[model samples]
Target: MRALHAPTRRRAVLIVPGFEERKITKALAAGADEVVIDLEDAVAVDSKAKARALVVRVLRELDRDPARSIAVRVNGLATQWAADDLAALAEVSALDSVVLPKVEAAADLVRARELLGRHPATLQALIETPRGVQDIDEICRTTAPLAAVVIGYADLGAALGRGAELPPQRWAAIQDRVLLAARASGVAAIDGPHLGIADNADFRGRVHWAREAGFDGKWVLHPGQIDTTAAEFTPNPAAVEAARRVLAALDEAAERGLGVARLGDQMLDEAVAVAARRVLTQTEGN
Candidate 1:
């Protein structure tokens, strides 16, 4: 099996594990940066083994391209299927990562790594519980080989009992905490799916809010969401150009022994430089 690595693109979509080959193909063609074949909530209890076998076959077929970032969202540690799911996937060279759902503590990550047993597949934790949110900082610090972390808003909302009608500010606060934790740990921070699959305006609004909150990306639930999320996460051309100009201006100032520089009416400092570099990094190879 090839070594595991981080995904290059921003948008990631979750596909049920038992999807037909053609459906999987169409999803990949829909412009998702990463495709996660879900084995947890998406699969029926009795169909776990079958879904696992199908996922393995699909991953082997998809991994040949090398450019495709394919992941599997295995059942949580509390489930009977979680061990078998990891064991089965450990031998697949094409698997880039495993999404471990309901990660509430650092020990869960440790157990997952041990189950993976030297395989190159990275782990992306799904933070869905109140304990997971509270211990997020410690989880981030202790977990090794963690590629990214994503909010599982549906489960989290249920656990918190905020209901479907919770205020927007409440959700924003939760997302901000997850984002801060991921950023502090120097890993990708992905926002949860919007859940309003057919609501383009709602999707765009949520995507914009996530982008503005400094999230790396958002989960896409449908093929229709793929293009919209991908576009939303990608830095705009004007922003990219402005970032380049900031770098250039900083370089010129350094050459002239200036401690500070001005870009229009705004002053350029380390913070501005950092933001500009982030823009360039995000837009690389676009």
Candidate 2:
């Protein structure tokens, strides 16, 4: 696969308390690019069924034109919550995707894809378990409506018995692994949030680390994290301007039917075209 970037807007997601219309509306108004009406961890186990019942109605209400896409992160199939989760999804037209937690292999995706019926709600395979990490590539590149592969690092850390840290922390390794798989397959990849909700410096550092690891965007667990994710993932103005130059050069070259060209003083081949067009696309999104 080739190196890649896309005209993606920042994917800052807020995990809201499920079964509640007010909380979902509040999170979206706070500027999260996507508000996840969570049926997984945020909803208590005792209230899971009640919460699941409200998801379809809540999504249909919030999922509006030019609004942030609504998603439901269903509890794992191994648990009691998944059956109703699938049922709620089948009833909703507003839901854009379903996030499957602790996905360990392609089979999990295959099951979710089947369970989603013929609805167009996409899949986001979350790689959080040790087995999920090991099977990251297989799970992420499935021939299904996989929106992106995401990481839940804090849970992953607990599972691995390690506190969160950067590179080589098993959590970071899997984050990169999932991103690599997503990029190779031309899908998207999102980084899990830094759990230090109050430690701004540390959280920003973690976001920076995720940026370098090739994650397209990140999960915004707290209200404070949303602005930072948007700022970091938005294409830099300088790069967007440069991409305009690249686009112009390509145009002139194409007029002469030339296969190779230069953007400013640099040669622009197929590889450069890919990277340059990404920036141009970014500019358009802005």
Candidate 3:
């Protein structure tokens, strides 16, 4: 039977090259809540077998708890390697999720479901093409076993040609579609990666943009990106303290049988109290 998808647990996910288990191990130790060992574009066509073997080995060693997420990004159904890839993945109990790259329709997920059988791992989609974006709604709403919808910035921009920037406005339609799909279906909508590998300032700006756009978090390539993404996505101490104050004042007011209250110069409402709780909850896994 199908199962509930694993929840997105971390403030950030580090996307590491699957063939390099060393890098994967380093990233995991470097504060990534999880790592996406990529076996597709990151691995050369000839090294697919090696990458799979490494990912499986890595999976065998890591904790698979939802709280300590570890996922694998495999080649799509169109490739000769996908079936074998799924077969290998099906054996690992340490896998929290399986990322399906370049999914264009629900049929991709159907094939994935058929392949996963009773393994019960969640499906995370990497939206890397216009077609994938066009069909993203049905993909996100297809029911359990599906988790987050991740944007694939580099590949998507390449797919759309030279005019498309890293975080292309050209694909805004698909971006909104993925967001609506994820939000409507109660899943996290993760933003794609930033190609500015060495520019910390630019990367932070891009991540802030993703947060503003309502993305859950970013898929990062470098370990340097993780702390920045996590810091940006998670509520800071000031915000958390403010939230705590809002809730505390409201609780005291309620205890005294007061229907409304004001915290300092600001008038507090149920909305403010809830916002405080939300800020705290957002850091649950951080």
TM-score of each model, in listed order: 0.87, 0.87, 0.81
Arranged by lDDT, best first: 1, 3, 2
- Model 1 over residues 91-175: C-alpha lDDT tens digits? 8887888899999988888899899988988888899999999999877876568878888888998999877435445688777
Candidate 1 residues lying further than 4 Å off, grouped into runs, are 4-6, 12-14, 63-65, 164-167, 247-270
How badly does each model clash, as a count of residue pairs? Answer: 0, 0, 0
Q: Which ten residues in a row have the lowest lDDT in candidate 3?
A: 1-10
Q: Write the per-residue lDDT of candidate 2 for residues 242-264, one digit (tens) a residue.
A: 77778788889999999889765
Highest lDDT, which number?
1
For each candidate in the order shown, give its overall lDDT on alpha carbons: 0.79, 0.74, 0.78
- Cα RMSD for candidates in order: 2.8, 4.6, 4.1
Estimate the overall C-alpha local distance difference test score of candidate 1. 0.79
Ranking by TM-score: 2, 1, 3
